[model samples]
Target chain A: MPKSLVSLLIVLLSVLFATAQTKSSSAPSDLPPGSTSLIDPEDLLSELQSQQGEKPLVFNVGPSILYMQAHIPGSEYVGATSDKQGLERLRTRVKTLPRNQPIVVYCGCCPWSHCPNVRPAYNELQRMGFTNLRVLYLADNFGVDWVDKGYPTTKGQ
Target chain B: MRRIVLVIVVIAIAIAVYEAARHSSHAKGHPGAVDSPAPQFSLQDLDGKALSLANYQGKVVLLNFWATWCTPCRGEIPQFIEFQNTYGPQGLQLIGISMDDDAKPVHEFYQQFKMDYPVAIGNANLAESYGGVLGLPVTFLIGRDGRIAAKYVGATDMTALQQKIQSLLQAR
Candidate 1:
């Protein structure tokens, strides 16, 4: 092949690879099983209410606005996990806890499939060697799945 | 004494039923009912201009609650732009209330999408007023009379929304 043609082909291939990487990274479903084990809304609520066994540390990784509007009572806000700063905050927050400590992360910003926060946050915790971690499955956003269902929620910052 | 007791029992039952019905409706997170007056609010748009439902009264309004990061909400913008262009002459007004935590991304998204409609940052109070915008892409169709004609949760069907808008525009 001509040198110019070869160069052009390489450039096109690079562009395609970059595009694929971008798309895959943005998709929450693309994460591995470590971040995929999900706790259903009702089940999580039941567990929280049950007060049996070790109480899991719940974290809200959605937008601050949504968190302020309504969030699971006692769930700490760690910012939107999709952002770099938010991920860093999550790392700092969990660094002192034991690896086996039960932790739950959730972002009901959008639909489960399109959520931009939870998977990233879950993966970050998994990377940090957290053994007992689960993602709260909010099929719809927080308002519909948790707030509207009459699940306990506290508003404000 | 027996007649008074019967009346008391009837009143108690009526109150119970009314309370149950009210709680049921509130639990559903549906504050805006069809044919009811749309909640009114005055907010500042990105450009610091005043945007209010009252300002758009006597015109059909398509009020959309969305965020910049929401994929479905992003998908609906172009179609909304098209709707504004196609229906503005007929008194169809599209208003966007972005629920984004910050306005920076919203401003970038607005420019990137070339959104023609006035967009504002919405707070918890505004979201609650519109039956709690718990989810993105919730849309409300307001008739010329300023009453809510329809409400759609989640990503909406644009064709049906357009049809509804057309009908609403024809009313006044």
Candidate 2:
């Protein structure tokens, strides 16, 4: 009933509204610590085509079916980052490798924004001290980014 | 006095709508909300047995959309099996929906993993109904009230998932 009470309520409501917006905002700039800097699919393709520098170890961190369907040429099949066991498997795969060796990870399971497997895998690699880690950005899916672009890809698991 | 009462109601409604919209966007798979009724669906399990969201009524449900091709999806199956076996007695029903195209691989993975829970084939339509499955192994936690409780988008921690299941089971 008091004016003061109503003014306090309005201020509280405004703060709550702002908090909700921040919580739900999934802007690209708000990338998680678990994420890696994105590498353009086209750039990777060109780099591969140039065959100038040392080739990076590329890993397909998507579904096995997608790998079998068509993945970047010479990309090794790493487990998806969807569950702990898969992450563990990937850890085992790179456990003994040289930490400084350049590595690129991509998963065309879905859009770059929503891929469940790429970020965790990227974070794990970073945590393992893989300094040259890169995430191949697939804006839509692999079919659109890599395959459609006529990039070299290998078939079968 | 009347103005204050009206203002309070408006503030409450605004907060409610904001929360709902935020949650809806997060679902990326389906716009399922924590107290809202879980979406319904009817599909054939791996054994061709018909299953509907209604079948798991009165029980806490963990609806998983996975793919055998997804290592993480495959990796998470053991826990689902464990939850089903451990909590099935306590009214926890686990349903796995494989997003894989061919049923052959799914069947092979199911048997190889010795999955004890019911698994069904999930299509894009099924995925769209839930929220667009952005990636493999999207998991949904549904309460006994037949409402969605949570959606885990990526690699899930087994210990945390179990703890939540325990709490939900005790809620009844």
Candidate 3:
């Protein structure tokens, strides 16, 4: 066999092996630790829109512009990083949310590691036994990645 | 026809400028009483007695929004208890709005902290009336006159609360 042909075959095999390893990994990216919940943004968006006529959809954590600049349309506003008032607003809303429907939560307050808002929301939902929970790991803040992706977003709170 | 077109263009430009100015006015940092005039609410205590902001009309009130489960809120509990006891006689009333989902935890926390101040479960109407809570450990200082004197969103230092109370008291 030609030397170049043998070398090319070896390279192709290595690439295939690497791709297989990544695919079989136990973890999925964009998820925080202890997250038993996962859902796609596209799925979340569709669910959110469908529920809009029946209920106010989506919950934005933190006081970041992600809630104000652009968010899933018809979403209710709650600041995870603001003051006690903000959290109270969230609590009231949470109590009223239907457990059967999907509730998508995101926050730009912190990256996944040190996020104060998203962690609590995720844990709280689990405690409440919410079966359908979607957490969007906005790489960095929402403005840089989520909105910049040209995803559907609405202005104002 | 040419003059009418010119007039319409000028009007559109003027309308656009006005809209831009209006949008900026409601920006996050617009200031001036963003969180104040706490919502009026009446909640029954664990004992089934009712209480509301209107009940404390003549005193300087501190509507401290908190949850027993919130670590930062708990961290400030000791100081809050102390501040209330020290300043209580002087007319500073610290009203705690507990946001705990379960009353058992709230009861345990109250016992552990020995909180003398009154507490009530939070509700949406109350939250909305007080400009809505964006996060935990929110403290709103209400003056005797009924307007919101100052709003503290996070865990606040006892000293800072004292300073705010002093000025609000002096204002009278």
State the C-alpha RMSD over the true interface residues for candidate 2, after superposing those residues. Answer: 10.1
User: Which structure among the candidates has the greatest DockQ?
Assistant: 1
Q: Give fnat for candidate 3.
A: 0.00
Deviation in Å, model 1, residue A46 alpha carbon: 1.3
DockQ of candidate 1 is 0.23
lDDT of 1: 0.85
The better-scoring model by DockQ among 2 and 3 is 2
lDDT of 2 at B6: 94
True lDDT of residue A33, candidate 2:
25
Q: Summing lDDT over every window of 10 consecutive residues in candidate 2 chain B, give the lowest-scoring window.
A: B25-34
Docking class of 1: acceptable
Pairs clashing within candidate 2: A64-B69, A82-B155, B29-B130, B29-B131, B29-B132, B30-B130, B30-B131
User: Candidate 3 regions off by >4 Å?
Assistant: A1-157, B1-38
The TM-score measured for candidate 2 stands at: 0.51
Task: Write the candidate numbers in order of decreasing lDDT.
Answer: 1, 2, 3
After superposing candidate 1, which stretches have Cα over 4 Å from the reference? A1-27, A30-36, B1-30
TM-score of each: 0.81, 0.51, 0.51
Instruction: Kindly list the per-residue Cα lDDT of model 3 for residues A1-157, writing each as its tens digit.
Output: 6676577579879999876554334223444443536444555555555745543247887543335445667666777633456666767777866786667777643334434566666666657777777676553345434443446876665
Clashes of each: 0, 7, 14
